[model samples]
Target: MSLLVVGSVAYDGIETPFGKVDKILGGSATYISLTSSYFQKNVNLVGVVGKDFSQDDIDLFKSKDIDLQGLQMDESGNTFFWKGKYHYDLNNRDTLDTQLNVFEHFNPKIPESYRDAKFIALGNIEPSLQAKVLEQVNSPDLVVMDTMNFWIEGTLDALKQTLKNVDLLVINDSEARELADEPNLIKSADLIRKMGPDFLIIKKGEHGALLFTDDEIFSAPAYPIVDIFDPTGAGDSFMGGLLGWLSYTNDLSPQNFRRAVIFGSVMASFCVEEFGPDRLRDLTEKEIYDRYREFRELSEIPEVG
Candidate 1:
């Protein structure tokens, strides 16, 4: 089973209490493909970059067995760029600047070969653009989407339309509440389910993630880490790892979903340990599973009153 990812491929400058990095290779699809590559070899990436994005970055994606045939490069413009600074707590950040450049006019064209992909992960992008990718894919078994408050607030109608076409919707806790207009998370999740997706995943940053379906709810806690340099791309990394494991195991059952959440949390913990996408870009499967084992051990506790 192949995984198809659609999102931005950009340059980012980030500042954190730990340090600062300027113009690093950072983007949602980039992180997702790189992290997911550890589990699934055939990852089809669909996004656009610009002339300034560098061939080295493309090569990096190729090294991970990511198929970049669908990744377009606009020779006329520069790739999207974003600058942000993180607070001391590492939980909140402020966007300093954003330059959409080529991404401002991004029109993803899904290749014919990529149409055979069984799993499709639509990273945070315009709802209309995500809809266009879905229309192009031939037969996708599972369609998961990630979105932010920006779309929910600015493009509610489009987001609602896009949600109806997806099987799973992934968003952070704040986005969930903003989208549902409910302060309570559980009720917010319920409202979102009514909007569209059968499965809703509310990512709670360091607290962990919560998965909700009509019949059940499962929660996974984030791994305790000593140091976190930057939290960028952590959510995308988690999504990548979760989807990668699911694709590799060829299991979409509830049991598999539960396990995938743990795998995702493990992957995310590694992502925040370094600046930008450094840690996940070179992650090994052994390392991932080792952390998974550690998480399992830590999570298992004898009956305690």
Candidate 2:
């Protein structure tokens, strides 16, 4: 099964308690596609970049064997850049700067070769643009979309329209609450699911993640990561690992969805250990498998009778 990811691929300047990086490859699509490539072989990426986009970063994509046919290079301006400073707690961050640059005028153009993808992951972008991408692709087996508070607040109508077309929606707990206008997370999931997607995932940062459907409500514990460096792309990485596993197995059962959630948590735990996505680059299959087992053991109860 082929996977298509449409979103930003830009540079980020991150400052965290552990350290700082002036510039690193960080974007919704960058982290989503890179971490997904570990499980999904046919990963296709689509986004725009400025001439300032370096060859090293291009090589990084190539190293993972990600298909880049849909990537566009605009010589007119610089790539989108965002700088944020994380609080000492590593759970909150404040944006220092944001330069939309070429991304300001982004209009996704899906290549002909990518039209037949089986899985589609729409990263954080304008809801209208996300809908445009959906219109171009073939009947994808599963469609997962990610959104943020910015779009929820500014483009509520459009976001709700787009949500109707996706199969799953992934957003953090805060975004979930805001989107549903509810204080309780479990209630938020039900409200948001009524907007469109049949499934919803509410990420709780270090606390864990919740999977919600009309028939099932699963809770997966987060991998206990020590020495967290940067939390920048952990959510995206979680989505990637999830869709990556689902695409690899081509399974959509409730039981399998639970496993995918754990795999997602495993990838995310590794993501925060380093700035950007550097840690995901060196992960071995054994490491991922071992971590998945550990997550499974987290909530398992020993027989008492």
User: What TM-score would each prediction reach against the true structure?
Assistant: 0.97, 0.98
Question: Candidate 1 lDDT (Cα, whole model)?
Answer: 0.90
Off by over 4 Å in 1: 303-305
Per-prediction backbone clash count? 0, 0
Against the true structure, candidate 2 reaches a TM-score of 0.98
Clashing pairs in 1: none
Model 1, range 1-305, lDDT digits (tens) per residue?
A: 99999999999999999999988999899888988888898999999999898878888898888999999989879999999999999888999999999999999999989998899999999999999999999888889999998898899999999999998998999999899999999999999998878888999987889999778999887788878889999999888988888888889899899888888888789989998888976776689889999888877879988
Candidate with best lDDT: 2
